[model samples]
Target: MNPAGSLVESLLPLPVLLPLLGAGAALVLAGRPRVQRWVSVGVLVAVVAISAVLVAGAADRPHVLTVGSWPAPIGITLVADQLSTIMLLTSMTVTLLVLLYAIGQGTSDDETRTPVSIFHPTYLVLAAGVANAFLSGDLFNLYVGFEVLLMASYVLLTLGGTRSRVRAGLTYVVVNVVSSLIFLIGIALVYAAVGTLNLAQISERMAAVDPGTQLAIHLVLLTAFGIKAAVFPLSAWLPDSYPTAAAPVTAVFAGLLTKVGVYSIIRTQTLLFPDDPVAEDILMIAALATMVIGALGAIAQDDVKRVLSFTLVSHIGYMIFGVALATPAGVGAAIFYVVHHITVQATLFCVAGLVERVGGSTSTTRLAGLAAASPLLAVLYFVPAINLGGIPPLSGFIGKLGLVEAGVQDGSVLAWFLVGGAVLTSLLTLYAMAKVWVLAFWRPRDQLPVEHPEDAEFNDLDHEDDPDRRFPVMIGAGRAGSGEESYSGAFLGAARTASDDERVPVALPRGMTVATGTLVAVGLALTLVAGPLYSLTDRAAADLTARTPYVTAVFGQTVDERVTR
Candidate 1:
């Protein structure tokens, strides 16, 4: 191997290995919260640097590592091509930021709520699993990657053992376990049909397989990935499962986990069955459903977290749409969309966490006048919210434009229909975000409606004597009066009596705010570099569609030539 090839190959495993090692070290340092934090942060920072190096090295050709000196088709292999490396770099960057945010919030170190010892290790393990999933070169190894991440996520999700969290975690586990079973079945079927579990080898062998059997295998695998990606009918669990977790946990899960499934779909569809018309059609239909339905669901939501969760589901359809087009332009756009969505979604959730802290709740009815209360927080929320709604001059708009252009170029009936659906979904997303903006940020505290009058009465009684109480106190006092007239009057009276300044800002944790602001800034920065990024993804799509580059790099020769030799 050339010197450059050797160096790139050496780095392939570190994105996975470093995190696992860090997790173990974090476990040993369980009693030392400060040391654990340093170890975790240092490890992710290293992974990010390594992933950046790999992205540069793998731009022209893939770097493949055969585990334990064994050759391809026999031993475990890890491949870092343009697609995987891009994903690794982007995911690690976001993971690092989210970790910082978590540290700032002390979510992982609070013993009374989450066990300080378990949180760091479990989080590192989750990072390893995401890296492993992106790099695995075999179906079984990919399955291992999924299991590793899922297991770690199970721990992370139930960290507090709150009844709501535990219940949500249970639902997450059952859904993922079933998905894993289906994935295993699909892997078994692939190996049974081809006598090898190596992905490159499977791709090579699948060409001669019976068409009916190919269709069956394809459907089974897509079903499993669909569930994982939270595509439409398969996505009900996501909105329910994600919102109940802690903010940092929800942020990371919202950003990375579903993208892994989408990445798998992109990999398999292009490599294994690039010409499968039926599957492509099915994917197109699924993409449209996921988009429209998720947007509508987002519109119905009143909680900030739940609204973000539904939007997460909705935007996933954009990525799927790119993949379903089955063109280099389409797939390239999908890849870009994934990158854009990961950063934006995570940023919004982090902002939601901040909102919860400032407002005392995420409910629209309870949150009001946040624009005046914390202009900084309002800017943080609004920037990403509009970006997510596909506002122009942002990464979100760039990505959606790419997909819409690709759909137009395809010029098929279904493609046109999806184009219309994509536009509609974008508008609906804007509407949902605008609604949140008006109710949660714009409306005055005194003008806010009370959802549960009884709860408001209880709150009023609970904090009657507390002089320094914040917005909730105002709400409760407002609701204690006779009716709307009395309620509004009392609310305004309390606000005036409490302070002459109505805009006295609630103090937010500086560390958490800085971390979230940094992430939001990163999301905005994507627009500046969208051109080079999209170009990279386009080349990646070309290679994926060609398939030869990946397979040849895997075995150090074309699969056919290697077989003949």
Candidate 2:
């Protein structure tokens, strides 16, 4: 390889390495948040730069690193193909901006549920785990990556340790632990059957394995990933759990974690078990159910976070729809949708966070007149909201178009059904968003549903009310903008410092707005660059379908050579 190739490959591992280093340093500097912020944010920014480099370099060739001087199927290998590199770039961008938003939250609120230092370390660990999952070249390492991120997420989810958080966190913990156990069991089964844990090796050896063994192992792995991805029946945990955490924390989960699961599914299905009819049929059915059920669920939601959470589940079906098609166009559409959803979804949750701050609540029923109070907040919500709802000219529309077109090209009856389901789901999603917009942003605050003493908070759903805390303050409240005069007042029981005019000026920490806005811009950037981006994903899906670039990069041997050997 040339020097340029070596440099690109060398950077393949840095996204995972640097974040672990920053996490440790953050732990060391736990007492000084300022230093920790610099360390964590600086590390993530560097990762973003490196991930972008990997994307640029991987347009033609994948970059691979062999750990401990060991060869493929022996040592831990890190890989960055067009697919993984793009995922790294997208995830890192979101993680960096979200970290900045989190920093703003820490600086503004001064609420000490969990200190900034601790949040920084845990958050960095989470980022590292996300990178590891994307870059891993083997199954064992992939499982390890999930565990690492799950551990970090457990802490992040229950950060405040509030009753709602703790209760929901417990459910989340049990579900993931069970999924992880199933995953481990599946790994053991895979190794026993295939004689190797490396993904590249498994891909080479899978065809020779018994059909029954393949089916069993495949089902087990899909079940595990499905639980993590929150696909329909496996999805009951997300809507309840995510709404309880702080805004930034929930946004991270909403944006990154399930997508990690989706990424795993993409890798496993395409590389190891491409074009399996049983798998495709199951995935197609699952996709249809997930789209309809998740959308209906979202329409029933009254809380901001829960609505977004259900929407998150609904969109996972879109990604699965791409996978079910099992064509290059299908996979490319899935990848594009994944990127679009991550940025757009995180922006909505951040806006939801801002809503919690500006309106003093996340409930559409309890909040009102946000269009009058903070037009900026409304606009912030509007762009991503429409994007998520598949309004035209946005990346979301492009992605959905790609998926529907792929389904049409597939020409299978099941595929056609899913294509229609997807369109219906899109319409339902828009309706849900419009419902929130009408109630939360358009209605006058005085006309909000009057809260009786017996009326439970939106998050309560059915959980018994804890006497100790009925409605604790949302975190991260500082004076709104740096230049704006801070008026001491309240908006619908929300802690507010704003001018007393009919339209209260909503002031958010500038960093938070800037971070969220940057992501919104990135989401838009995808639209502007859609042609190039789709071309890149087109090549990536071709590579995954070919299955040679990834295998040769990992094993240092051609597929023919491996087969002959």
Candidate 3:
């Protein structure tokens, strides 16, 4: 083995292992908020660094490690290939910044019944779940990883414990539980059919299965992943649930959660049953419907958060379109788009957090004169907003263009229809963003009817009964918003009463600003590095479609022997 490859292989498990360990440490340090901060943030930073090295080295080949030196097919094997490492790095970077933002929001001292503390440990566990799913070389492990992250998210989602947060959280929990149950069923069916849960071994076994059985298994897996990915007809849960969480929670969830499902879909489609035309056809129709329906829903939304949530669902179609083409270039474009969307979407939500803090509202109808009040805020929102709308020269445009090009190459009528849907979706997204800009930023502050600052009803807030009026609220801080004292669902307690000017002013913590600004910079960084990123994804797609590197790494089988099985 190459020395560099071996080094990466040795570090492959750290991204998952370190976070799991750090979560336990966070539990030990629960009483010390400051120490918990250091422990949690330090673990994430280390995980990102490790994941980055693996992504940087992925072109050489995948790094595979069997835990406890157990045999590959029978043991728990973690594989960090180009796709997995890139995802790991992107997710960790976003999460670390979100954690910093959360610390600024003051979740370190989260008061809950557990006393074991929830925020730091739960957040770290969430990171571990994401990493585990990415590295999992077996189907059952992937299912476990999903449950881990989803459960952690359950706590994060209902932090405030208000009627609204709990209601939304319950909805989230029920939907995910059902989705998970369906996913387990698919796993059982696959295992029973193939007698192995190892993905590489399944690949070998699957090739021998009859076409009817393969199609059945493929649809089962897609159905489970589809609900999680929030594909149309299965995505109604997201728009309602996501907008209810605190800003930092919402930002991370919006950016990272659905993409995990997309990643699973990508793995299954590319590695397990690459040639199923039936699934491809279903993906085609679903992609177009998702794009159109999601965009239309965004246009109908009056609240900034809901609009963004709907857009998030809309753009997922573009990724699915790339996957549906089932070509290397097509999947490559999907990969690139996933990276772009993660950063941009999270940045936009962070900006939304800022908007709520500074403007005292995320409702465009209630917002006014933000551009004048905070030029920096406007700029932050503008960049990602346009990037998301696919304006020229941004990463979004580049990714969409790549997908369209791939669709054209495919030359199928369904691909062409999806291409058209993507274009229309982009135009509608731009319009929806423009509507927000005009209402929230450009209008005079006084032009919008001024309600007394103390009135304190959140138009964008779900407006449920907040039984406990928590104090010490930090609006835009992105933690929890106390009931009857909602500060745009970010800070759980009120800090100090705002004066007339301070109430309207864009005063944010330095840590919060720096973290939000860093993410915006990361989005810009993606634009600057688009070329190299595309090249990397292209190589990843090629390697994935060929399916040689992964099998060789895990099963210790040559390509011909593996294919002949």
Candidate 4:
């Protein structure tokens, strides 16, 4: 422990606490949509501010808070290490942007509920859950954080009540629930084996245990978290469900959820079971399969959102590759990669929503001529698409380069294998993005058609009892633009009357431009600040590798002997 340093603390609880309190307020004010929006934004603003303070504090000193001050290993603790502080900051930024976007989107317009007030409270809870997960120092605390957000997510995913959405949501719910159960069971076994749920204590205890039992627990915990992370074989449910949600919901979910899983993997690997060869070996194999199979699925998907969702799965392998390397440089690269990927993925999803809004259908088959139709949007899609594909100068390329460099330095067969797999995945990612670009943006507009009038009527007819039946009208209008596409009689009438707003000539209501623009600005901020941002990430990575700060913060003392990795 660095006893020479002064203890640092602040009113850091605002990040999570404000959101929780605001959520209750929002639920109480459910009848007032405007009030709900304001409340959600205010909560997010406070969260973002608190996160900034934490990040700044982490730059100077590690910030630790014991909930009830029982002591290390017994009391619940929240430690703002550099990695977690950065995650908190990024989560707040994304959440704020999404909330603004949703505001402009209007709650009544959401397909899920007539009064969109539940979104405010649920989203706050979800954000708070994420902050809690990132900051928690105890294994049991992490479990509670996961449960907190998962319950909210179950509702968010099933927001709209269409048959496809309901079906997809059900699958998502079942898979996540089963994974959560496994996680609880794993926690129980770990506690039984080690006598404590404190992460540092578990790390200390694991060294004294027999290798076989340690290996069994390591594999069990990995399997549970692997499912949460959507690793190869356990990842089938992500693609089936993520694409069906509302765009804002999908964007937030995509940004935060899998990363939470990856965060768990990072925590467990570094803290709980650092030297388990079986776990390392499993990660190596799983990283390859996840990257390959996920990319293949992206290649085969016609839906633009679905393609991106599969690509998200593919990219998770990259982070797993870093964890598998088990080196300072590798871990650093993984942390950097996580922030870059989260922002990039969320931005891409937000843009996908825009694409669907502007071009009518997100299906590659139905989308065309976006480049000519709305060049600004085309720019939006292109830059992030290229970033996701690991083009030079973008953060994605920088992150991947660091990982590959670390792999070369490690010089193990497994590390080399992961490097090769990463390269292949990058190529596949490029191919997938190019497929989207070619099919949706480069094609002539005449090849695509707006929705048929009969189909429009059918959609309305089929979902008449549904809360979101009105959305098809707006969605149909998003499809009306581009070059020479013709619409059915009914669709043409609806499309012509949709809107005169040059920003969105489709089905979207005139009021949403502000919201869409807000989220877009969030993406822009990351790109504009990439220089200073990467520096922060690099420093955070360095701190994350220096294990003493975190250990001392949690336990108030550190062991003299260095633990073997």
Candidate 5:
């Protein structure tokens, strides 16, 4: 068998299917946490391996897996083009790292009520949803994928159900449910108008329709995805919801979910409604508003996670700018940007969690003197932070360069203005990151004046379990202590010590430097592989913009003339 063909067969579906099966197996034998953790790790590793093979072999051919041996348009399908493969591989790697990190930083004693048991199942389900969204051949299937992931997220976001978390979850749930409803309505309209749910069929039909009807459909779908993507007017739900989740959960959501929305927008723009008269104008205005508003929110934030959340919302504008350009280079840059942002943003959020763990809090007002506490942690924090702010020599620099260059060559005055705004946004992002660094890592203790414990007369509460009072991080139970709240517990008759401490903080382990190092290495991999990655992005962009391969592969035949405007 040809390696490329075999590679395609194994690469596309196996990553998702293997995990789905593993989640079921884990649930069936849920009595054992150790077994569940190991099974989840093994499943994720398998996914990573398969993803790597796909990325390596993607140069040979793009793979399309028809799930049930039925033809694509009628049956669900998964397609692994260069861009989708890249995202799939990265998402797997980041999620696995977060899971491993979480394993070490065990849950607090309140695990049962927090939906921690559902973590493995829901995480895999979200992964399946992501793969399905990337691979989906039709509009309705994309909606289904979105629903799978969103519902899973609703559980994950409110995992612990702390007071703040419940509030955040309510907002997240309501906003997303509304978006889902809009998405369904838009899909129904598209299906009724075009008489087909396949993406290519819709595109072909859209071309035959009048500009008014076509734009109406396009804008309707965009509105739904815009909310999902957290774009300007539709983006208010993001900052409040995202910052409240646990570290690993927040990391995965930041890394992958919003990008899925951006991906859908790109696919719809480049494939279904190419070069619409209104796309550039509308997106340009929206991109400007998103960039400015998101940046301002990031700057105003005192909490580390909240700042990062706002930054994530703002950065989606760059993707929108690329898609609006309607050129292969622009879309290619968007693909590159999406991958770059995923790694950098996810890593930064994880590092922020470590900061909150090590320092007493993530609030800039409270955190200080980390340089004295741990320089290694500072390095872990600074590298990705600067990279995310789009500093040169990192992958972010390369990605932003691609987007700006594409804008310059695009020949639209508006494009030039957007390019300028991107530069300004980058600088503003740097300012925001620098504010965090100064407050959290670099400021001198004497300058800020440490709090006087003597004056406060703080007491470590001692109960019967006082001899055993311990906060655990990454399995630091026996004598090792952490300031952060934990989820340690006992079985039916076992002695259990449980209490809530709003004042104490979670501390990162000495070895967590390893987790941070792993993430930094992943970022470096993007820079190291820049040439090959860019080439792959170019090919993917060409394939997407051409739209022929996807159409023929999914629909079995090209759409008829009546379906195309």
Candidate 6:
């Protein structure tokens, strides 16, 4: 290997290692919230820088590192190819921004009930897990990555310890536990059939196995990854689970976790069973179902967070559609869409949090006149909402266009059907976004109908009823003079203050706003750099299709040479 290649390989492990080390440092400095925040932010920034370097270095060939100087097949290996490095860089960047938003939330009056001590360490562990999953070169290591992240997520999801959050966290835990068990069983079956768990070795040995056995192993792994990715039938748990957490927690999870599952599917499918028509057909069907059903579900939701959660599920279909087509254009489009969704989805969730902060609830029935009250917040919401809806000249539109073109190029009956389904899904998504805009942003706050009859008596109260006339009399949990302290647990389960006098409006934190705005700009920037980014994804897709660069780099020989040896 060249010296440059060696240097890149040497840096491959830092993305995973630095976070784990930072988590430990955070644990030691648990009592010092400010110091812990600095540690966490510094660690992630370093990871972002490292990932950028890896992306540049691994563009042409993969950089492989064998842990503890062990042989490739016998010990763990980490490989950074174009696809993994791109994902690594994108995920780390988003993670860093979310961390800053979280810090801002903690320092503000609207501090999350979750302790900063626990939040920092758990969050960093989650970052490490994402990095590990992207770079893992073997099946077991990938499984380990999933477990690490899942464990951290369990903590993050139930952070506030509210009954609703605990209930949702339990549901999330059960579903993931079952998925993990299935993945473990699949790993066992693959090892029993092939003799090595190394991904490159398994790819080479898989062809020699019986066709039936190969298909069986492939289905088992796909089922496991599909559940994790929240594809349609397996996705019912997500909407309930995600909306209950804090804004930062929900943002990071929405942006990165499911994408890890998608990344796994892309890696295993292209590397292990690239020629399986059965799997491709199955994925195509699943993609269509996920797209249509998720969008429809979003339309039915009245809550802001729930709507975004549903749309998140809906867009996963686009990526699946791309991968199912099994062509360079198809895979490249899927990769591009993944990057676009991560940025847009996270930004929208952060904006939703800000809405809850200002409006006291995320329910459309409870929120109105936000544009009149805070035009900046309204702009924050509108740009990404339309982007998610696939408006022209945005990253979302570019990605969908690539997928549609690839489908047309294929000219299969199923591919053509998918193209139609994708278009219909986009239109449905636009409707859903518009509905939220009209009801939550455009409607007048004074015209909002009463949501709870039991609290109607409070609606009749005059200014004289209040001892301190600092703000208007409270009308249930929906109306206040300042529009910020009505405190309904309608969506986020925010706590209500004891007295209306204490219900002064809390200003939106500048750090949180900056973080969200930066993410939104990043989403727009994707459109500006679409040409070069798409070219990179195209080259990455070419590498995934050929599968030689990864194997050769890992084993120091081509698959043919290794098999012959």
> Model 2: per-residue lDDT, tens digit, 288-370?
99999999999998888899999999999999999988999999999999999999999999998888766656877667888
- Cα lDDT of candidate 2 equals 0.85
Query: Model-by-model lDDT, in order?
Result: 0.86, 0.85, 0.84, 0.75, 0.75, 0.85
Can you write out model 5's per-residue Cα lDDT over 328-400, one digit (the tens) per residue? 9999988988988888888888887677566534667656667656777788888888888888888888888
| Poorly placed runs, candidate 4 (over 4 Å) | 1-8, 107-112, 449-504, 507-535, 560-565
Error of 6 at 292 (Å): 0.2
**By lDDT, who's the top model here?**
1
Which candidate leads in TM-score? 2
* Candidate 5 Cα misplacement greater than 4 A, ranges: 1-3, 108-116, 449-507, 555-565
How accurate locally is residue 39 in candidate 6, as Cα lDDT from 0 to 100? 94
TM-score of 1: 0.92
Q: Per-residue lDDT for 222 in model 1?
A: 97
Residue-level lDDT of model 6, residues 494-526, one tens digit each, is: 222223212234556576788889999999999
Which 10-residue window of candidate 4 scores lowest in summed lDDT? 489-498
Record all residue pairs in model 3 with backbone atoms less than 3 Å apart, i.e. clashing. Answer: 471-493, 471-494, 472-493, 472-494, 472-495, 473-493, 473-494, 473-495, 480-491, 480-492
For residues 1-565, write the lDDT of model 1, one tens digit per residue: 5898899998888999999999999889978878888899999999999999999999889989999979988999999999999999999999999888887764344365466567888989999999999999999999999999999999988776656677889999999999999999999999888899998989999999999999999999999999999997899999999887778888999999999999999999999988899999999999999999999999999888899999999999999999999999999999999999999999999998787656556777667888876889889999999999999999999999999999999999999999999999999999999999998899877775433332342122112343233222110001122332122212221122222224344466666788899998999889999999999999999999999999999987996687799
Worst 10 residues of 3 by lDDT: 488-497
